[model samples]
Target: MENMHIVFWLLKDISWCMIWKPLGVAMIFPTLIISIVIAWRTRQFMSELCHNVAISVWISANSYWMISEFFHFDEHHIWGGITYKHLALIPFITGLLILMYFYLWWQPRNKEETEIIEA
Candidate 1:
């Protein structure tokens, strides 16, 4: 009975690592291409490019994490005391970078509008 549970868990882990991870990584390019075409038609190419790049970074992090796990690279500390499993930081940092870039650098801020908000 205990062996059956172990087998099921192993199969689930295998499917996640082999099937789902690569599938997600593989789908990014087609989605980016489609986004580019639509953006060009709408004359919003730069916006779409930024969005696609951000998406790619996020997906790349997932792929990296899975690859690292499969190869056991995630178990060792590559730099600081934290283990390589912390490689997921790439995606997290990327998300924060984009969030700060858009909110701080790109968006237009006006004092009058800021003060008038009802929230």
Candidate 2:
């Protein structure tokens, strides 16, 4: 029946608002702590701090989206508008790039130590 379908859809919507949204917010804390530890260990303090801050901003945006989606808030008015969902990708990509840069270019070279030893 049409009524049954409507009820199912409404339940789905409510569950999305209540459960999944809060879960998204809860996920950010571990991410931030992990980022900070990794950054400190690598000695890229500034870049690590910047990247971690950027990730926090990104997580806040996600939390906003979760709140907005749950409350059925206005898509156009909120800070994390429906369109802003794509903003989550920015932090992820940025973090990946930072990691890659550290691994590929920023890591200290053993070659210099070897040359000094030979000299």
On TM-score, the leading prediction is: 1
**Per-residue lDDT tens digits of candidate 2, residues 77-109?**
425444544554565666567656644664454
**What pairs collide in candidate 1?**
none
Stretches of candidate 1 exceeding 4 Å from the true structure? 1-14, 17-47, 109-119
| Each model's total of backbone clashes | 0, 0
Candidate 2 segments whose C-alpha is farther than 4 A from its true place: 1-27, 30-38, 41-82, 108-119
What is the TM-score of each predicted model, taking all chains together?
Answer: 0.52, 0.38
Tens digits of lDDT, candidate 1, 24-103: 44444454344445434544433444555565465456556766776668889877788887978878689668756755
- Measured by TM-score, how close is model 1 to the native structure? 0.52
